[model samples]
Structures are given as structure tokens and as C-alpha cells.
Target: MGRIIAVANQKGGVGKTTTAINLSACLAEKKKKVLTIDIDPQGNTTSGLGVDKNMVENTVYELFLEECALKDCIQPSVMENLEIIPSNINLSGAEIELISMENKEYLLKNNLDAIKNDYDFIIIDCPPSLNLLTVNAMVASDTVLVPIQCEYYALEGLSQLMHTIDLIKERLNPKLEIEGVVFTMYDARTNLSSQVVENVKENLNKKIYKTIIPRNVRLAEAPSYGMPVNMYDSRSAGAEAYRFLAEEVIEREDEDAWL
Candidate 1:
């Protein structure tokens, strides 16, 4: 079965979509069959991989509300080994519509189970809220990759997201675990960035990813062009960081299990 990893953060502008797009690309670059599911209504993940929104025949929204098959919604991306189940603006209505359905939280989980084994990894780009949609993502995922932007209110927004995860673990997916906490947009020259890094290392029980994503303008611009940083500028700091993060992720899959 594939590992369903939800790249989530309740706070917007925390690099959630950025991490989802680039990390999936890097993982696919390593020859792993990868699939990205855009659960966010923003559709940033879909566009980040160069998928045109107007051309999408089906999307994750249809899987939830339009009786569309999850497998059929998956669109092949620019990357050879990566596939994406795109999400467009139509998903915005799924929140209220889901309330009337039976087993609301399990909708995504049931839809994803059919094609879990088809890929090595399934990365979910969660919506930036603790709504039914985000809950659905949490219930569907085996693990969560939190992209914490290194800023003043970094840890402040985590309380609710963590609490929601706890509730999901207790009531829904008992096997769910935290994949890791990654620091994104870190400006190492600043005292604030260094302090945040230290705080994450000293306070959090979860494994802090060794690769910290530095704040890079190139990383920000890549999405506007509908590309990952790796494709946009392979030598940029953002590209190098994501590549390192991917290697660390693969390494930990083997080494940490032995420890």
C-alpha cells in the first residue's frame, strides 16, 4: 500500500502547497511512482505541476460530490513519474455539502483506498483550515507533513491543527502518525529564524527534518509559472533544499526504522 502523506498547515502562506508540489516532484525524480492529491480549494498544487485548471475534465471535488471515480480524476503531470488528482474552485462548495452525507470524514479515505497500491507515495495538499475538508484529508492520510514557515507566529497556529490531528487519531485513523515537522522559508541570517529552529528542536517531540527550506524568491516565483523550483531553477536555494529534504525523507525510511 502507498503511504498517504497529507502536507498540512492550518495557517495560510506556510509553504504547504510549495512543499507538496516540489517534494512530490523530487520523490518522482528518484524513480518512485508518486501521486499528488489536491484537496485544497485553492488548486495551487494542481497549477504548481503545470496542470491547466480550465482543461481539467474531472477533479478531487467530483470524487467527493459528483460521483466521479478517484482513479479517473488523476491527471498525468509534466513529470514522468508523477500524477496529480487536481482540484479547482468547484471544491469550495464541498464543505457544506459534505455535512449532509453519511460518514462524512471517511469519504476521502474510502475513495483513496481503491488506488492506494498504484503509487509509492500519495501526497495530499490539505486546505488551510480545520474544516470538514481538512478533517477528510487527515482521516485519509497515514501521516502528515507539516510545513512550518519560520516566522514570528510559527508555533502559535499549530495548537488547533495538532488538536484536530489528535481527535482524528483517536476517532478515525488510529494508525496515523506525524511524518515530520519541516521548517520552510527559513532565513538563517536572522536571529528569529535561528530561534525558531532551536525552539522546534528543543520543544517538539516529532522529528524535525534536517533540511530547512530557505526563503527564496525563486521558490515563490516558480508557482506563478506553474512549475516546481527544481524545474524552474535547479541551482536555486529552494531547489537544493527540497532535494536535500527528499534525500533525508528516503534515508529516514531506512535508517530511523533501524534505530
Candidate 2:
């Protein structure tokens, strides 16, 4: 079965969607079949992969609200081994729509079961808040990967996210675990960036990825052109960093399987 990972951070502009897009793309480049599910109503992940939100027909909105099958919502991306379940503004109302349903948290988990084995990895880009959408993503995922920006107040929001994860493990999905914490938008020249990295590594309980995502202009610019950093600029620092991240993840999985 495919490993489901939710790339989530309640704090916005922390490179959550960027990591989701590039990581999925990078893994696919390594010949792993990957599926990226954009549950964020903003649909940055959908557009980042070159899919226009306005042109999308079967989106994640229908999967939750209309009880559509997972296969019906899947769309092929421009990348060779990558597929995506795109989302748009239509998913903004999913929180309210999901509230009255019974066992609402398990909706995504149950729905993804039938298609879980069709890929090597399923990555979910969650909305930037702890709502029903995020809860559903966590409930459906095996682990959650957090992207923390190396800026002021970075650690302040982490406690709340960890608390939510704990609650989900206890009440909804005990198998859920934190996959890792990655530092994003890191400027090595800044003392604040070094300080943030030190503080996070010293305080955060989860494994911190060795790959630190630099503040590269290419990373920011790739989305505007509707492409991942690797495809946009394979030689760029941002692309290399994400490629290293994918290797680290695969290595960790191998280690886990041995244990």
C-alpha cells in the first residue's frame, strides 16, 4: 500500500504547498508513482502542478460532499509518474458541509482505501488551518510532515499543531505519527535563521529533516509558470534540496521497514 503523508502547517506562507508540490514531483522523478491531493481551497498545489483550477471538473470537493469515488477525482499531471486530485474554491465550504455527517473524520480515510495501493506515495496539501479539512487529512494519513518557516514566532504555532496531532492520534487515528519537521524559507546569512533552526532542533520532538529549504527565487517563480522547481530549473538550489529530501525520506522508510 502507498504511504499517505499530509504536508500541513496552520501558519500560512511557511512553504507547505511548495513542499507538497516539489516533493511529490521529485519522488516521481525518482520513478515512484505519486499522487498529490490538494485539499486546500486555495488550490495552490493544484495550480503549482500546472492544472488550472477553473478548468478542473472532478475535484476533491465532490469526493467529500458528493461522495464521489477517488478514481473519479484523480487527474494526471504533466509529470510522468505523478497524478493529482485538484481542488478549488468549491472546497472552501467543505468544513460546514462535513460537520453534520456521521463519522465525518473518517470520510477521507475510508474513501482513499480503495485507491491507496495504486501509487507509491499519496501526498496531501492541507488547508492552512486546524479545521474539519485538516482533521480529515490527518485521519486519512499515516503521518504528517510539518514545514516550519525560519522566521519570528515560528515555534509559537507549533505547540498548537502538535496538540491537534496528539488529539487525532488518541481519538481518530492511533497509527498517525509525525513524519518529520522541515525548515523552510531559510536564509543562512541571517542570524535569526540560525537561531530558529537551533531552537527548533532543540525543542521539537519530531525528526528534523537535514534538508533545509533555502529562500530561492526560483522556487517562488516556478508556481507562476505552473511547474515544480526541478522541472523549472533542475540545477537550482531549491530543486537540489527537495531531491535530497526525497532521498532522506526513502532512506528513513527503508530503515523503518528493517526495524
Question: Which pairs clash inside model 1?
Answer: none
Question: lDDT value for candidate 2?
Answer: 0.92
Predicted structure 2, TM vs. truth: 0.96
Candidate 1 to native Cα RMSD, angstroms: 1.7
Model 2 lDDT tens row, 28-79: 9999999999999999999999999989888999989866777888998879
TM-score of each: 0.96, 0.96
- The per-residue C-alpha lDDT of model 1 at residue 187 equals 95
lDDT of 1 at 98: 80
Candidate 1 yields a Cα-based lDDT of 0.88
How far off is residue 134 in model 1, in Å?
1.1
Best by lDDT: 2
